[model samples]
Target: MRVQNLVVGFGPQNDTDPVLNGVSFEVAPGECLALVGESGSGKSVTARSLLGLAGDNAWVRADELSLAGNDVRGLSEQSWRRRRGRDVGLVLQDALVSLDPLRPVGREIADSLRLHTRLGAAARHARVLEVLARVGLSDAGNSVRKRAGELSGGQRQRALIAAAIALDPPLLIADEPTTALDVTVQAQILELLTGLKRAGTGILLISHDLAVVGRIADRIAVLSEGRIVEQGPAHAILTRPEHPVTRQMLAAIPVDKPRGLRLSPRAAAPVSPAAAPFLALSDRADPVAPRNTVLEATGLVKRFTRPDGTEQLAVDGVSFRLERGTTLGIVGESGSGKTTTARLALALTRPDAGEVRVLGQPFSAASEKERRLLRPRLGAVYQDALSSFDPRLSVEQVLRDAVGGGRTGRGAASASAATAATAATAATAATASAADRLRVLALLDAVGLPQGLLGRRPLSLSGGQRQRVSIARALASGPQILICDEPVSSLDVTVQAQVLDLLDELQRNLGLSLLFISHDLGVIQHVSDQVAVMLDGRIVETGATARVFAAPEHPYTQTLLGAVPRIRF
Candidate 1:
């Protein structure tokens, strides 16, 4: 497979700016060619153009585009559809959004066979199970019946890959396929791709993760704006990054940084001591003896009944403590109860048996009334912020809602004055509106967002921008403790670095405690002071971040760390 002088643009007008400006690359048989670039750098557009799926608005043109010695420069949609599954397989980035939410996993995989093969129902079903097992989803009996939502993020990703490779296509175009996976699962997925490459399947790998590309990619193409600024062997590009953009991306990785240091260009400045505390819940309490422990949990146990009516323990005998102004990173593979533990810590889910204490107060056993009172101090940032956010609401409204009923009370008071003094009431409403606007501005500044985005909704913003908005929302209520669940898993490395830096800066400036949960050990090691390795619903190892990473005590912890691909350069 090869491409030369590929160009793509929207609208019929040739004068319009093109997304891909003469971009060219190739993937020969048994070789993996990676296209590395930041968001909006035409990587996805280039991949979609090959399959004639760049949407109606796109106009694709290439001087030469051939696969398996067959020209495909300007194929019709119907022709491209016929060739898609038989010639090229596509594994998209976000499996959750890509896979059909309403259909069973088996049906989704079988759709590919139905499109490109003449296999009957029984044979297709059997083939689906075989492909699922081939992609490391061995529990095809159960996984086939389950919906995409029922599986973990990594499992969903594998299902997508299975569907892509179900017909055994010669070319595989994987666009950030492992973006949302944890380190261990990512390693497994890369190994699977490597096997496909060895099997003579040419792979066009598109990603922003250099480490992932460095692991399995044979050649590298560093894209900046709309062009490939550097292209060479993977080792040469990684070790000697000739392009400045590539160097910038390499420097943004979290592994090279120390704890409590800023990775963003805008360094954190000390907030005024007299400034109104935002998300500082513990400080408002009556002065007492200084306590180091901010959050603690012991003997936490949660059980769920499976579809087969079998009880499964999700979190068992989990205990840990988080000090004030510190981060505790929980690392583990998919379905290992890491997310369940995070939910339990935030009291988002009730544990069957356990005790949770937050800021020296009983939390897990607290009544609804008690929990409601304590809710103001607790905030959370989820992996998918767009799902958590209200699509109809603008960024400004989202932040204002996080401000809570206080703003509503002000509006109510202003309305009450309308009957007495119309002019004065108008003035009061204006004042209240200005105050709310100022508060929203402050939150945006803290999260490093431009004031221009206040009117935009979540859909209008990019993935990284939505995450920043989520972080701003989390900080709006002035919470003492924040729980971040895979906050940067779906983000590119450059954006991820900024978010990590922002969290560390916020913790230092506001003295907020963090419960950081992720599958990426490199991220955990950078942002966390203490680390806890969870496996099979239990804490397999716990220690200081540096100590554990330097010399892991448990084999599981060592294995998790070892799976993380290092950029030797």
Candidate 2:
């Protein structure tokens, strides 16, 4: 596959401002070429142009564009469709969105074989299972019957790869394929791609993660603002980058850094004077001094009844204490009970046995009324910020509602005002309204978001912006403890860096306790003061982050560390 002077643009007059401007690259047989850049850098647009899947509004042109000796430029929709599965296979990033949720995964694979090959029903079925197994799905027979939603993150990714490679196309295009996967699963996917390359298949890999690119790429092209800023051997580019953009991206990686060290060079927004008191509530004392325990769980055991009527233990005898003004990172594979433990900590899910205490008081075992009063002290930020927000609410509305709904002081005052004068009640309501607005604005500033975004809905915001809003919403409740579950998993490295830096600053200023859960060990090492490794619904290892990463005692922890992709430099 080769491209020279490729240009792609959208709208009526696309040539005025193209997304991909004069981009050129090549992927030879038995080799892999990677396009690395941040989001909106024309990586996905280039892939789409090659496959003729660029949207209807997009106009693509190239001085030379060919795949397997056939010119791909100006190909009709029907011709491109004919060449797609047989000539090239495309593996997208989000497998959950790519695969049909209602259909069995095997059918998705079989459809490709049925379209590209002259195979009978039985042959297609056998080929589906064969590819599934080849992609490392353990129980291919049973897996074929499961829908995409039924599978874990790694399993769904494998299913997507299985469908993409069923026809054994000469060229494969993987776009952010490992972006959402855990370290070990990402390593497996990288290995699979490497194996495919060794089999004489040309691969075009697109990713924002330089570490992942450095692991598998033979050649690397650094894309910046729709152009290739630097192109060379993978080792040379990663070890000694020439472009400023490349250097900035490398510096943004969170690995090999100590806690509280900023990942990005940008400074965090200062806390407003009005919001200062709220953030500094716990900051009055020495931050490094021996602090009290903010949250604790003892012998936590949670079970769920499966569809087959068999109970599955989600959290088994989990126990941990989160100290004030510190971070406790929970690291594990997809179904290792990391999220379940977080839910148990938040008191969102009740444990069948055991107890949780917040601020040295009973939490999980308390009544709903008691929990409601204490709820203002805790907040949560989830992985999918867009999905977590209400589509109907503007940014201002979301933050304002959070502030008004969770203000324990206001609630108590309102209860006392039931017998107070009506004029006094009106005055109090007006005062609260003004305070809520000020708090909302301050929250936006705290997250480095512009006040102009106040009127926009969450769906219109970018991935990073949505996450910032999520953080701001979590802060609006004046929570001393923040439960962040894979909060930065979906973001690109640079944005991830900024969010990490912001969290570090917020924690330092607010003295907040963080129960951070993630599958990314690099992020865990960066943000966590203490680390807990979970496996099979239990905590396998727990220690200081530095100690755990330097000298992992458990075999599982060692495996996770070994699988982490790292730049040679």
Cα-lDDT of candidate 2? 0.89
Ten-residue region with minimum lDDT total, candidate 2: 281-290
Least lDDT summed over 10 consecutive residues: which range in candidate 1? 405-414
- Global local distance difference test of model 1: 0.85
What is candidate 2's TM-score against the reference? Answer: 0.94
Top TM-score model: 2
> Where is model 1 more than 4 Å wrong at Cα?
100-133, 139-155, 266-285, 288-290, 405-433
- Per-residue CA lDDT of model 2 for 99-124, tens digit only, reads 99999999999998888789999999
Task: Kindly give the number of clashing pairs for every candidate.
Answer: 3, 0
| Top-scoring candidate (lDDT) | 2
Could you tell me the lDDT of residue 435 within candidate 2?
A: 79
Pairs in steric clash, model 1: 278-478, 279-478, 279-479
